[model samples]
Target: MLMTTNEPQSILDRSGMTNAEAGALYRLLTWLSPSFPVGAFAYSSGIEWAVEAGDISDAVSLRGWLAALLADGSGFCDGVFLAQAHRAAETGDDGVLREIAELAAAYVPSRERQLETTTQGRAFIEIARAAWSYDGLDLLIASCGGTIVYPVAVGIVSAAHGIPLAPTLHAFLHALASNWISAGSRLVPLGQTDSQRVLASLEPVVAATAGRALLATLDDLGSATFRADLSSLRHETQYTRLFRS
Candidate 1:
């Protein structure tokens, strides 16, 4: 007797679906999508300068820079703002949200990094409102008088999507690290396998950073001043470059 083949079903198909689950999945995919209009592809966040300066000319150096960045600087700052924004949105407190937005805007040290956060933020808000119709998100967008910062947008969208703040913050940092690794792989001529290794090396850092972010307050948004700020400013006048910043 010949047995008939029974192909396994996808997890999505196997687990019975709910509207909430579908909505959450949709929001996660949309937020993480490269085409989400966050403009993440355009900015290199000063890694370009590190490459040009011979400081990050190899995978090892690039990984070190990225690790310091995520653990100590913009990554940590953004996570704090994201958590604050989430709380403000949850409470329907526009005043708190506005304050958080202003703080995030002022947190960046260089012109390029400043433009990077706010420009992509404003763009993300527009795309988010267009793509996902959430009432709270609409309210938040309408409240923004000018450019919104990236962390603000992340918080609002994460709340709208029903994702917890900690995991959302973790994913944001992970994506940032990965983006830098990809840029480094090209700029430094690192092999794809080496790039993967660099990213894998960041898993523990990401977890520790997220844990730290959870306990972080608004007052804890300090960064490593010299390298981070100087690199970003120097990138502005770099005679030749592959990245915008």
Candidate 2:
């Protein structure tokens, strides 16, 4: 039997490839920056509903809710969408990209969720195009023919900029989880330290999820019955809500 190493040792060994290292850093910083203007702060992704419903009123429930969402719902959906978008962009198929965008757009069950995906997605693409100046990115923007979904924009920009899918997707998932956790902290009135502890506990989930998502295909884009969707739907009618979605 023979064993093989899958590491990019050759690429890591090159000292003159500072551009590659810088590019990765830049992408990471941009994706994680609170100022990226993805409108992530405005939408709680149904967390507000969960909090109001008392489903996630404490740190324990908050952690559990977030974990389930990341493991079974949006995390999986986004992973598949990201991969499909990457493949579409790689092939330079505008139709495929549009289809991918539509599929992602339709996956969200609630109107609020749909709005969040499209709104953040369009902003993300516009910002990336204006700041990064990548080749295929412009084509993707034009091909959108309308507003692009968030996962699709992420996939396109990541692939166009030569960023690996795993890291980009992982960062996106982590940021999402972090945003929810931040919301939980505010809603549950959990201390800042407890929030950090909860986030630390999610590190393993993020790492394992990223590895799993790397192997995921379009066939794997399904959601579990988490009740969060129902919460989001109900949020649309909630009278005195602090968050948009």
Candidate 3:
């Protein structure tokens, strides 16, 4: 049987949309782009403190710090939140979405960390609303009542726009790693080549975290990077600072 170009051949077809026009790759790239104006470059996520404390003084140390984050720290927690929020959005569960947002906001271990996520989250929502406005995301933001966490915002928006969950989480983690690497580069004074090498070595960690996050729930969320959390708190009082947190 000959099928028309727009006709579905199987029940797996969703909304008669073709994979070629799904726009997942383009949306992910644009939303995560450095120039997206979410102010991602202005925050260090405590890398500033880590550098000052000599915890991340070289490319090797930087990789280790980020690996912990990806494997079992803020990255792990955020990835879980992102996945749950994505599921909530996918299921049209405003209650679950709100719960996730509230929990994520309250889970931060320090004031600076809170500021980092909330501030960036607000900025991300603003840009997304202004540029990539969508009803699902609009409702999610409206439902949050002005307190959305960064990962939640990213998750809701991605799910609302039909970006698959795993890739969205992967892109989120990669964007995070890239931002931290940029900060480490300036702080550790690593050359461009070394920075690239560090990111390359951590690819497996990022992939593994994303995979785990896809199947993880709130129960799976936890951070073992106590010192890293402390660095964020300490960064709040660090006399000199190049980044916000």
Best by lDDT: 3
* TM-score for each predicted model, relative to the true structure: 0.89, 0.89, 0.90
Query: Worst 10-residue stretch by lDDT in candidate 3?
Result: 6-15
The alpha-carbon lDDT assigned to residue 105 of candidate 2 equals 79
Could you say which candidate leads in TM-score?
Answer: 3
Displacement of the residue 80 alpha carbon in candidate 1, Å: 0.9
Write one digit per residue (lDDT tens) for candidate 3, span 1-245: 97566444342266454664455677789888777888888888899999999999898899999999889899888999999989998888888888888999999988878888998888877887788778667777776656898999899888888888888899999998999899999888899999999999999999999999988879878889988988999999999999999
Candidate 1 lDDT trough over 10 residues, lowest sum: 4-13
lDDT of 3 at 201: 96
Off by over 4 Å in 1: 1-18
Q: For each candidate, what is the lDDT?
A: 0.80, 0.81, 0.87
* Residue runs of model 2 more than 4 Å from their true location after superposition: 1-17
Q: How far is candidate 3 from the true structure (C-alpha RMSD, Å)?
A: 4.5
**Candidate 2 or 3, higher lDDT?**
3
**Deviation from native of the Cα of residue 89 in model 3, angstroms:** 0.7
The superposed Cα distance between candidate 2 and the true structure at residue 7, in angstroms, equals 29
